[model samples]
Target: MIHEKFTKDSIISLSNLTVIKEIDDYTIGDEQKNIFFRVPREAVYVIEEAEGHNTIEEIQNSILQNKKIEIDVLDFMNTLNNLGVINNISLNEGHRNNFIKNLGKLLFNKTTVIFYIINILLTIILLISFPNKLTPNYQDTFVLSSIGLSLLLFFFVSWFLVFVHEGAHYLAVSATGKKMNFQLSIRWFWVVIEANMNTLWSISREKRYIPFLAGFFIDILIINVSFILILIINDIFVISLLKMVALIQFYKIIWQFIIFLRTDFYYVLLNYFGVSTLTKGSISYLLRKISSKYSLFFDQLSIREQIICKRYSWLYVISLFAICYLFLFFSIPTVFHTLKTTLNILSAFAYNTFEFWDSFIVIALIFFEFILWIIAAYKRFKRGD
Candidate 1:
């Protein structure tokens, strides 16, 4: 029988998935799959033995004599071949190469990096020296407009900034000369900009930091540019709008600290620590202490996983509380306050009056966020992840 061989790029890494031990993990990038898979230790040895120099009988006989175990060489070779590890076919290798090459052309060089640092420093100085002037008056955005118009403006500006943020991330990834997969999806209330981060392993640890943070930098850039525009534009309406956008950007920056949301900062911390599954593993570690089911599965984790869990469990708890605090203190209160106040104002006007309709629209928009949370929760429940 013909013997299949491991590709030259096929690498066997000792992966620590559980708290107890290391396991064989395979990375076969030559086929352009760009995925890692855990495999049985014996399977790894079998692939190693199948170097194509030995026939199936010769390989199996050698293993049996050395380890005294029965083996099926054909099935094993077929399994590895099926997994794309043997590189039997060329799959998008050219596309992947071209993408990285093109991305190299768009990356920010050393000069641009210096400029970014200077820009951020200036923004900090300006914000410190003139907080009141730079601060946004959210009231100007909603109080002066009809409910419908305010909602439209808010969404337009918010989405515009969001796109720019994602674009910054795209450029950051490209700068590293790596392939990235970017997609737009809505999960419950927020439009999420999802970027596939599997290939992050291929880049240097320091370089990975920029892609995670590029979005926030882009946000700061926009805020600074808007500040300059604010100085030049005399129109009160345009000035107010810019201030509002700037305010929202400020809020988003603070929102990064709420780690339970798995914001950009969370990823940065995870990358810095060199852990793959911090939150999930930490939560599972906590769960294992309370239940047998959790323990049974958790016991399978490697030592690295256990360490990640122990190290991050406190953070997980703090982030959980932070999420609750924000929800209860901010989200719940704001929605209720807005709804109650709007209803009272509407009661003072006839239902057919513009004042009543305006108030009604505000209430609807407020509830939109709550509706999104409900939808997202329901989705998670159904998927059982």
Candidate 2:
């Protein structure tokens, strides 16, 4: 009856996972290789209709007014969960405003040359004291144990780096006689330390670039130093930690391709495009313009997005779909793999005390992403035409 019920079962899961349907909401589209159930757009409408009082049969029968739901109804329900678009509870409006408000509050500091020097010394000492601290192969070692240690190392070190990076932002703002507030923000499970220095409007682009680039600078310096240590050190602990840090730096570069995420990379692209929050806002602005003379939907849209829909609807729509797919499969894995790898290292360090929690945190992060996605999409939909 319930969607979670279907996930708990076997046959229903394997048989009809994703329901592809026509844009018109009647014809059943092609089914891709179904790893999990993907709800149809039609089902989304039905679910909305059935939110509280409507029965499944009634909803299904309604959708089938002219055409039937060829896939299993329960399967469709489970698919909603898989796609992360549906849930038992009414979805909470995501923290879109919090994100914008966080701009000034989200600045972070970076590691200076001195920090790198100390890190190098520590790595050298560790390598010298124990040249052959063997860690278990992932295959031979228990999955839970390996995963657990990996998580612990990742959590601590990752947090440490974030703190240092964010701290640099805070200090920079402070030096200018401006104060900031900090928060742990998530952009789809990629942990970001955000510091708001909203008062930094008068700050020069050069000053702004320093705080933005500081984190990666520290990460790059640390990573290269790790590579130097790796040239001699035979220990898994030392090598893995360094590798993890380097990998994180590499992962952040995805921000370049995305043209969003409010990273330095994104800022570069936005400036080039002559837009703020360029990608998401573009399509909606276009849509509003195209539809204003034709569709009432455009009339009801938010003023900002209405402007976007008018200005760049066609381009915006294409980019929207393109970026969404890119973010989901590519960006998601890149971050998770880093998180997973980091966790594996930490688990090794901690002897895997909280394996369950490690898995939970990872999964929780994955779920949290959809909310951000919604906020972004909503903003795009509401951008000035």
Candidate 3:
């Protein structure tokens, strides 16, 4: 005889993730860290047959009556137990629901949406009214009168703006009456606030779109508000600072369109087309094409799925081109310019002067950022992700 512990509240359902091929996609879920464990269809049958009290042989006998299945009962039990999804402590739904409701109350509704629309329109109009302030003068705005202080200032300001951006996403998710989790982590050498996307799956697709897009909307708001503030502010230092922040916000807006990065727009595109794994599928197709080998990448899909992939592939290629162009045209030039300016400043100032120390700080920051980039890249490579 054998005994097993499995949660009565455990869910076995189709996965929300989009896949390349049409296969039976199922996931097991419990209240464990909002994570789901995906398994084969046969595993679902095994779980259903287990029923906690039944011995492994008894469960096997029941399943075998209908079909032959080969699953190591011990291994299966261990996996679920380790995942804390089977026979785990029950979640306090009442407390969770109450928290979600409280958060939901803070979300923007129709009336608030209307107000936001009006503000957004007004902001655009204001931006169009001020053409000179749109072009960024990084030196005056970011460097201030002191070069040494610039990197530290830039880091803090950028962090604040990102906090606001992520906060917008949090509010958007809350508005949809979904639970959200946030983590501070590094991505591509930059520290970023990561919102748990798994929580979004419980909500409507349309509702999910806004949460993903909320950051970009906030970025636009930042830019527009900076422009407005610049008009009223008399201080050159303040104006220059705001202008630089505005330019950074503007660059963030452009960053959203790089769909190859699985950016906010990437999610938008996926939701709009009602497809999953579009980017991965497109890349595979492109790779096959490059090898002068036609594969059945599209033929395996349903006609509708085929069309989505076919259309999305071109956009994926376009995103790749945009990334290359941005790196070569924008990134390289900025790095070169910054390095040259820093070197000049360092040369002009004596080692004992504040200016030299300032230049040294900027140089140190540059090296630190580069090191972070290398660490991130190496980790990703080792993980084969």
Candidate 4:
């Protein structure tokens, strides 16, 4: 009985899997485990033949007869089994709900697409019509009744917008029949809410674009609505608040385009090139070029990957320099000036005064943001991410 079970004639039990064809390879994997592999066309044929009805020997015979190529049937079966792709499993629905799924689909329909385009065009027209609002002013951030209250309001509203951004990514992933996991994380010095859409690997490359760009799309929508409200609202306070909201949304959209920060556009570029480790690989490639000590790391990459890394290294280097320069000159100076001004205000005003409270609030907000960044960074380090 044991010998018979081990024979090539034994039926193969393939797990539920998703297979997508890329430009040069096929992406096949078990979505339940969030594991995927890029294989050649021939490997896809082998996988297709692994239905329960076919025995291992029969699958090999069929492939050989059709493609005139030989493959080790038992070895392939073992490989799949090791990868947990030869087991029975179902899609994990514990994190998903029907309402979110339906809403996700609704948000990406043809009607919504038309509105998205219209919103973008209208926003451009408004910006052109009112060129004064094109530049963002820091004064807009303090448009509320009191400076302290305005600062608090901006903090809460900024976080609310961040939630909406991540929510858009979640909805887009749901639309593609996948669920997303979100985490409060830090990117460089900024505290960010990130959505992990790794399950998207199971879908086609083209379908992944919307989920990646969804945050930007929603930001644009918010900016468009804010601009419209600013035009219609006669009250100065309301107009100022709307302009501030629009300015923040505009900043979010621009931030997404900073590819070096591994923003949405960065992922879009990775998907377009069908390269998974372009950023890491590019950095390794540059390091290897700088010294022989890094040769071992660069040599670990395949020849094709090496070429890709070499090609992308220049862009990475340039972006790195640009970011370093910006941080040293713009960001550092802005921080010092803000801190100096807040300290002066605090010293000039009595503790009972609104001016003193405003400076206190600014310091408290800065400290709060710093604490969040520290926690996020610690969590990231613990996870080895």
Candidate 5:
């Protein structure tokens, strides 16, 4: 809630504000509310001067003297107050300092980089030296005699690794003195685990990269460790299971590179370009151009961003076509084959037999994944995302 009135004589103080400069405007706000606004650079300077030491009148006069612009200090303070930026609430640091002190050294140091490099080199050398043993095979996923049991085990292990991957991201953001939200979400037709750290916008671009790429780093580590274990172990079952895990991790890494899907790497690219809403802006611009029925979202963008979106809109259109191609050629056929195989097994095998259970479990898992996707989609729609 905001105070009802303010006088020019009143001293002004701002909440903990994050002001990041972009191509044309500055993104400024309090991260506690996860709310931000794009203000001009002059407004940012005014915000910086509102540190509770000066009266609104003095601050306005100072800005007039320094920047030769006469701003309504009272109106500006009222606007900031309405936006929850000029508040008396003290944010809880809550072990953030400790987290930065500890995890910062453990995860973001030179020693860790060297260790990661060594692991990568060792993994490469082992793969080259024993290509046959290191290469992933589909048969490795069916290590158990019962196909149903093998698939269930694989599914559980894959989900556990997903948890670890998201955890890495959570920890990285925590190290930067921020919190991240974890959710079960859907990406197109696939159910995915996600970590939402929108507050990262309040942080510097360089610090933001680690959190975005943390999952990829963890996946690489898992792959390397799995390969190392495969070389050290002679048991066929152990080797096969390790190979399956490594394969899944490798697939995840590749999936992140699918920029059209808005993967982690996509966020990295957005940060690198210092653009906040490139994907959404580009898609909306393309839509508005095709049909005026759409909202004037594209017209609302800054000139610099409008140009960027116009250039990227063509690529966005191509990616949409590519998605349609993949659905027609790959996704539909794969689902069709799985259902066909399951139906045949169900018809041929007795109800109590392992073959019947295998088919039943596969169908059940597919249904479960579909239900999850539905739930995620509903949540997204409700939020107007």
Candidate 6:
């Protein structure tokens, strides 16, 4: 939900924005930094980009005029959406109705909440109906229809989880009385609400991780309950549940090991290293470790991490490059794979809706990824990283 035109050090000054006109769901504004808008802290980075005084037309043009949304861009937008981020809007009252400015924020917030509630419900329903709905086989047409209907019902569910994820961050930081900006994010393909309080760098790591991690912990809790529900409902509705389209809801839960795609696993790795940032430094360390000359730097590292770094440093580098390249160079295959799965889900209205191939491909890819992960984990584990 966040937008930006990255042109150097532009910072939006709210005073400069004037609602030039309004048309239906859209509003036109003159861009400038003078008029500071009250955005959730997370969205300020994009807001920072709006400082160059490009008109609304220019912003829209950037999106529409472009052809393919490249992997870097997709990643950027995805990051904006999925990570806790916010959008900056014209803040001054005179520019437009004061309450109206809040419209976007309110709508986005509600969207996030609704997503979480639905995920909880659907995940639970799918589980109790387990292996039946989620399995690779179902022969009846009527059962297939039921499953298709279930998926249709749950198709638009996800952003709510993101909102909770971000809201936890907002509340966590707010609890410490830290000032934060609210922003929505689109990390990869997911939309999220975010609280911007990087300023909390001054806070201890535990405090920071509490806010950073609250969302995933909650997700794990939901997954566990869903697993229990699968057991509870197994005897009564296993076959019927299979007929329902809500199966495969637990795949994400099952494949947590793939641990790519900037999920909580990434956070766990970063936390393990005690590094505040990973995207930059991890890469640097990876590049340097290739040379024996940097062995001294590795030696200088803390006993625990030095061993980890020295051992899996190559894995760290490869993983970083792989993610970036998978996103950029292999964008076509990635998008194609995503689209193929989407179509398969859509076809559930007619087909069996269960296939060995479906879970196999996804889970297999993750498994392969884990095999590589073992290489890194082995070094870390052996060295106590």
Model 1: how far is 281 from its true place, Å? Answer: 3.5
Stretches > 4 Å off in candidate 2: 1-145, 175-177, 189-191, 268-281, 284-385
Per-residue lDDT of model 1, residues 1-385, tens digit only? 1234533333322121111112224322221345544445555456556554566667777788887877776666556556555542223423345554455435455556666777788778777877777755445345245655575577678778877787777777766655566654444355455565645555555667778887877777778877767768999888888876876676566566766567888878876765555676766778887888777756767887787667877786666665665566545664565567677878788888777887777767657756765665665567453
As a TM-score, model 3 comes out at 0.73
Per-residue CA lDDT of candidate 5, range 239-336, in tens? Answer: 88998898678667657755778888788878876667788787787678576644477788788888887786676656556566555644566466
**Which residue window of length 10 is worst by lDDT in model 6?**
20-29
Candidate that scores best on lDDT = 4
TM-score of 1: 0.67
Q: Put the candidates in lDDT order, highest first.
A: 4, 5, 3, 1, 2, 6
Misplaced by over 4 Å in model 4 are: 1-12, 52-96, 281-337
RMSD in Å for model 5:
4.1
Model 5, position 244: C-alpha lDDT score:
83
**Candidate 5 global lDDT:** 0.77
Model 2, 209-241: lDDT tens digits are: 554454544554555565566567787766666
Off by more than 4 A, model 1: 1-34, 37-87, 94-111, 135-143, 176-178, 182-191, 202-206, 227-235, 284-308, 317-334, 345-351, 359-385
- Candidate 3 clashes between residue pairs 3 or more apart in a chain or in different chains: 7-87, 18-276, 148-358
Root mean square deviation (Cα) for candidate 1: 6.8
Q: What is the TM-score of candidate 4?
A: 0.80
Candidate 4 C-alpha error for residue 246, in Å:
1.7
lDDT of 6 by residue, 1-385 (tens): 3455433232333333332111111112222222111222223223333453654334334544553221232333344334323235543323333343343234234345566566667655655676553432212212323333333322333334446555655555455434345643434443334455543443444445554544554564455454555455756444444332222223233322333345555655654555322334334456565865454554554555554544444555555564554445334453455446546665564334354344344444445545645554554456452
Considering TM-score, which of the candidate structures 1 and 2 is the better prediction for this target?
1
Each candidate's TM vs. the true structure? 0.67, 0.41, 0.73, 0.80, 0.80, 0.38
Whole-model lDDT per candidate: 0.62, 0.47, 0.64, 0.77, 0.77, 0.42
Question: Which is the winner by lDDT between candidate 1 and candidate 5?
Answer: 5
